[model samples]
Target: MLDFLNDILWGKVLIALLITIGIGFTVASRFVQFRYFGRMFRILGASQAFKHDKHGHLSSFQALLLSVAGRVGGGNIAGVAVAITLGGPGAIFWMWVVGMMGMATSFLECTLAQTYKQAEPDGTYRGGPAHYISRGLGARWNWLAGLYSVLLLVTFGFCFTALQSYAVATSVGDAFGVPVLYSGIALAVIVGMIIFGGVKRIAKVTEVLVPVMAVGYLLVAFVVLGMNLERIPDVITLIVKSAFGLEPMVGGGIGAAILMGVKRGLFSNEAGLGSAPNVAAVAYVPHPANQGIVQAFSVFIDTLVICSATAFIILLSSVYEPGSGVSVEGVALTQSALADHVGDWGRSFVSIALLLFGFSTVLYNYYLGENSLNFFSTDNTRLLNGFRVLIIALVCWGATTDLSTVFGFADVTMGLLALVNLIALLFLFKPGLRIMRDFDRQIAEGIEQPVFDVSRFDDMNLDAAAWEIEPEDLARIRQREAAAVAQGK
Candidate 1:
């Protein structure tokens, strides 16, 4: 029954829905993801020094790191191996395609998350699909919000945590002969210490760890690619031809290639899955679209940069056999490919990388669930505490056991959550577009910094306090605009 449901939800329904929504948002936003690519970096660079916000919001860079922590995980390593094994080299091409389209989807949902965000009692910001669904769509749609929250809680909080833990434990056990039980207990303890510190600690830890892990991984990949520079063209050609079933090596045909690519691509980057926006909304930005654009760049980094690294490593190696009937799945396959290229130490490197990737992912997933739990009952400390304990338990359980069943169940839940989020995104896309336009207009008019004016959204169902501009800052912005206007004249 679980397999059947997963096949229906993820295999059939979601593949089309994810593609269509991605394309729709891309077109609707006039390819904002592409147009603002340079600005994305500018915003990120400008946000490096964390700003102190009285509302307890994270700086934009911290938020970007948080989302990237979730995006670049075991999926980038193990998931890429699985895609190549099943779908052939052509799967990598499809992954790139979905990632490009998913960037736009990410932009839309994250912008909505920022637009409808609200303040929490603890002086932090809270928003996501649920917050936007209830706040943007009005009270009548609160049920949809609740549904999204519940699905998010189940998918990320429980299932994904287990899956991440399992990946780490399995990899470490395979590499070092460590017992899964010990790894599970250690993972649980480490995760508990960070999560218990709350969102601020998670943000701070990821801000440091994400950069180190991602850059280190990419640096190693560059070395490998440099070693195989002559085969780069052949690898690229193989990927493209395999993607369209033009290559005979892609035994499963075009259909399997598309499925594997889209599934793992979405899983790796999480562009349209509605998970990233929960963190995206926690950033303090001059405009809602600022964070959205930052997140769009994250999709690029995850799929095009990190995931491509994994693909290249495998494709450039002799260990990858496209037609072999032997099963080489997940992290083990990745480790084998690296080991083939660089020796036994390569396997140990992969295991260590997986530990960092999985641990950070566990933290991000926990925060997503905690945020959703807050939506149900903000005052229910007892319930929130209970959920945290449950999350820790699930982490340990996942480490000690096989999670094939857990993964299947998570796929179904995640598909439903994505469906709900995509629907909300479609409904609220225009408002997000308006926000983008407003931000663009400011940039075009030579404003170095764009600020959002809540007055522009007076007719909409937004929390005024969320977008309130301080008088002093508002005065400074007006003075700059005035100077720019005079200079134009």
Candidate 2:
């Protein structure tokens, strides 16, 4: 049964859907991901990203860290390993494609999350699929809302929780020869302590870790690549060729190459999975759209930058070989390739990285689940506590056992989420488009400037008391937009 499910997941149907949606987002957004590429890094580096509210929660960067915590985890490190092993090096290319397009997908979803956000009893704000669906989707056919919540609980909350713990335990077992059980217990304790403070604490942890890990891993990979600089040209050629499925002659064709690239991208960055937006919703950005844009950049950063770096390290390493048996599959394969260059220490290093990535992901996933459950009932405090405790138990369960089943379950769940999220975006598209246009106009006209601060409505309309946006800013942006539209005519 597991074999059959794995076959289906690794086979065409699911792949087609994932690829199609990625392309769909890329096309529908008119390649906004590419058009705005240069700004992503600058936006991330801006001090505004790290600014915080007095009582609301963490800063935008903190929220981003928490979100990155979920995303950049096991996948960036271990998941890359999995893709190359299963789909071939071509899979990494596809992952890049998906990450590129997923920017807009995440932008749309996170904007919607912010757009339809609701205030919680604790005086903090929360929003995601459920909130957006109920608001933009309306209260009428709430059955779909209910179903989405359940899916999130199962996928992001429960099943994924198990998968993350497994990654942690496996990494530890490989690195230090620690028992998986011991790793599981440690993970549970760490998660429990951090999650106790909610998203803020999670964000604090990830904010420190994400950059360190990303940089540390990249430095290691770059060092390896530098040692083999002579082979860099050939590796690049292979990547391009493998991406086109034209080199090794193993794939169906260039079409297969592109298709695989897109598949890996979506799986790696998870733009439209409706997961990242949950974190985005909690971020206090100028406009919901601003958060959306920042998140779009994140997808690019994750798949295109980070994931691609991992692929290069493994492929460029001298010991990399199909025959090496280190990467019998994905993440493991990456570990082996690194070890070939770094010695046995490489395995331990990979394991430690996975541990950080997986635990951070678990923390983020817990919040997602909590938000989903919160939509059902605010009084479910007891339920929420129990849920957290149960997840802790599952952490232990995940570590000791092979994660084939849980990973299978997560794949199915993500597809189901994409369908609902995309549907919500259907209603959300008009508003989203307006903001995209407005933001672009503001930036182009110099009225809004690059940061495009819109934290409150008054910022966009200065006449409005609270979030007073300067009229000069608004008029300048409008005039430019008109001129651009006229030029198009």
The CA lDDT of each predicted structure is 0.87, 0.70
**Backbone clashes in each candidate structure, one number apiece?**
1, 21
| Residue range 36-129, candidate 1, lDDT tens digits | 9998877876564335466566878989999999999999999999888888888999999999998998998898899889866666678988
- lDDT score for residue 352 of model 1: 94
Model 2, span 332-441: residue lDDT tens: 77777788887988888888778777877898889999988987998887898898898888898988988886786777776677667767766767666656776677
Error of 1 at 286 (Å): 1.2
Task: Report the error of model 2 at residue 291, Å.
Answer: 0.7
Q: Any idea how many clashes model 2 has?
A: 21
Cα TM-score per model: 0.95, 0.85
Model 2 misses residue 431 by how many Å? 2.6
- Give per-model CA RMSD: 2.2, 5.8
Off by over 4 Å in 2: 1-30, 41-52, 248-263, 322-327, 449-489
Identify the runs in model 1 with alpha carbons over 4 angstroms from their true place.
48-50, 325-327, 471-489
